[model samples]
Target: MSQLELRGIRIQLRSQSSPLIELPELTIQQGEIVVLMGPSGSGKSSLLHWLVGDSLPEFDCSGEIRVGGVRVDALPTQARRIGLRMQQPWLFPHLTVRENLQCAQRGTETPAERARQLQACLDAFGIAHLSEQAPDVMSGGQAARVALARAILNQPAVMLLDEPFSSLDTATREEVRAWTFAQLARQGLPTLLVTHDIQDIPEHAQVIYV
Candidate 1:
């Protein structure tokens, strides 16, 4: 189990003198989801980007991001092992569902083991039947689940979710949200979820009002 910690975080947009966000300390406990609430332009997504080592150079970042004892802010995006899901699935148009998940794996394991892990994610998402289908052919909910599975297969030390369920319809949102929380709980990873809607905050999650 690992905790995600941020210390003395600050970010300034391009040409802006003032920092948009100035956070002194934020720590997400192991196996818990921390819900981040703020208005649309409050730099919530930018904060997540900084943590995952994906923030643009246009935004000056100052902070220490740590997962367990390792300083992830010093690592490159690929080496950070921090998973991120966004409003858009952004599944590759050319890749099939199974291939999308398989390609996301940083396979130190044998090919057979990697394939097995892919199959497991497929079965877990109930998308094993749709494994060969293109992402465009799937429904919105399927696409979201597939994208989430791919993110999980990335095998991060922590996960960042930015309005992950906001794009879905009412029924689909409820379904995906429940499934997502269950999966996150089962995986036992620290997760930071950013959403404007209060209803999206699960009962067990910690709320960080920004």
Candidate 2:
């Protein structure tokens, strides 16, 4: 069954000007990837913001955001169980790569199990050696990888990506996109990817143009 669903979703930024988003309905099945594409200011980011319960106070939202069959619109952002990856990576500058990943681990019954999960994730992302490295010391691509590893370490029911590869060069972008999709598939988690770049859309992605 699909882990994420948006039904009759509509959002409007309370501008002195006009509405920001007009999405009607969107659904993502388990392990599926849905790509949202539009030009800048077309509300792509706004839609993602609403899905994860981060709709700005200046925005008015009327919709149902469901994750694993649970309505999450009324829930706090931390309770949504949705992992979000933005273009800037958003890793904590003060923490080492391992600490960032460790902080995101979820559902483990014991500290040893959580540590094992974190170590496995770092190994899978090919960043096991970076465990002790500070964010500022890593290259851009490496930092982005760490950010993604952290986001998935929580084993979210769904994942939301906002132009996550925009900072990478062409080759690196493709590599990371493939890595991300593969990881999501392995986790059996539905994903909503928001990006203006068409190349970022994977082969099986269902595209929504806003």
Candidate 3:
């Protein structure tokens, strides 16, 4: 099972002497969700970016990021096996739901296998019926599911969620939040969720205050 490890994490703006966030170490085990809770500007998102190796140049970050015991902090964003889902779905405007997901998958599998895999992911997200629909035509929840499907198709070792449910209506937010956590757990992903809302915390989840 793959686990995510962060060691000696520290982040600060280049012009600032005080660090915004500092942690000696943190570990997210397989099938676990660790919620990072803090108000806005608390460096929750910055920490995630550092783990993915995409921290803004204006920020000074130092950390040892590892996945399944393999160090990956030195890798580029695309090379690090990390999945990120933000508040916005960020789907390509012109692509159909199916097409958007298709672009995230990469493998040497045959065409038929690839199609099957894509279809399975869509079904798991409860979005198979909307496969041919455009993102513009879908509800906020539907679009979010498609975005998550695309992320899952990428098959990352660790998942990072930056308030992914914050944009949805209350009902939709509750439903989608449950589904997302369940799905990620089923995949045995080491997940770190960043959110300011206490309601977003799942039962039994490990929460860290920033």
Candidate 4:
């Protein structure tokens, strides 16, 4: 029943008086994906940073963010219970794929149950073979898949994606995008996706221009 709600969102450069992005309200229900599209410097990513509770030292942001009717804007990033996948993959270079994914474990599942889900996710993402490899050894596509697996494993209340499929080949990109949307829908995770490509938008997604 968790839904992401944002009200009175306004972001602006600290050095300027004009707002970079402003929206009166936005709501993303569980199992729903909302796409944010805009030009290169239109504050799409900045809005997501604000949602994820990231430090925006260069910009000033004002908004109310809530999940399931509870305020989360004042909470720390981790405390806000949101997962983010950026264009860079952001996997741990020092750890093996499996270990990196293990770092995302946050549920109370037993060891056996956890292992089962991990393998299932790896297989689902077509990355089971890369489980023992380091991030540096994987291709951009592989790394992206691994990064996505970790993000889902984290089981956040909301998922924020920042051009997550931009690195994949055409065919892989479509496949991964479809699978990702399906998985998120199945899990009932509210999602906000930022992308420049219209092809990235899923059917029925609420598209907002920044």
Candidate 4 Cα misplacement greater than 4 A, ranges: 107-117, 123-126
lDDT of 2 by residue, 10-57 (tens): 767677465666666777889899998988887778778777777478
lDDT of 3: 0.90
TM-score, cand. 4 vs. native: 0.91
Ranking by lDDT: 3, 4, 1, 2
Compared with the true structure, model 3 gives a TM-score of: 0.97
Any residue pairs clashing in model 4, and if so which? none
- Which stretches of candidate 2 lie above 4 Å from their native place? 16-18
> What does candidate 1's lDDT look like per residue over 57-170, in tens digits?
889889888888688788899988889998899999899988888889986999999888888888877789989999988989999989888999888879999999988999
Which window of ten consecutive residues has the lowest lDDT sum in model 3? 46-55
State the TM-score for model 2.
Answer: 0.93
Which 10-residue window of candidate 4 scores lowest in summed lDDT? 178-187
Pairwise TM-score winner, candidates 1 and 3: 3
**Which candidate leads the pack in TM-score?**
3
Off by over 4 Å in 1: none
Query: Listing every candidate in turn, what is its Cα RMSD in Å to the true structure after a full C-alpha superposition?
Result: 1.2, 1.7, 1.1, 1.9
lDDT of all predictions, in order shown? 0.88, 0.84, 0.90, 0.89
Error of 4 at 113 (Å): 5.4
lDDT at position 195, candidate 1: 94
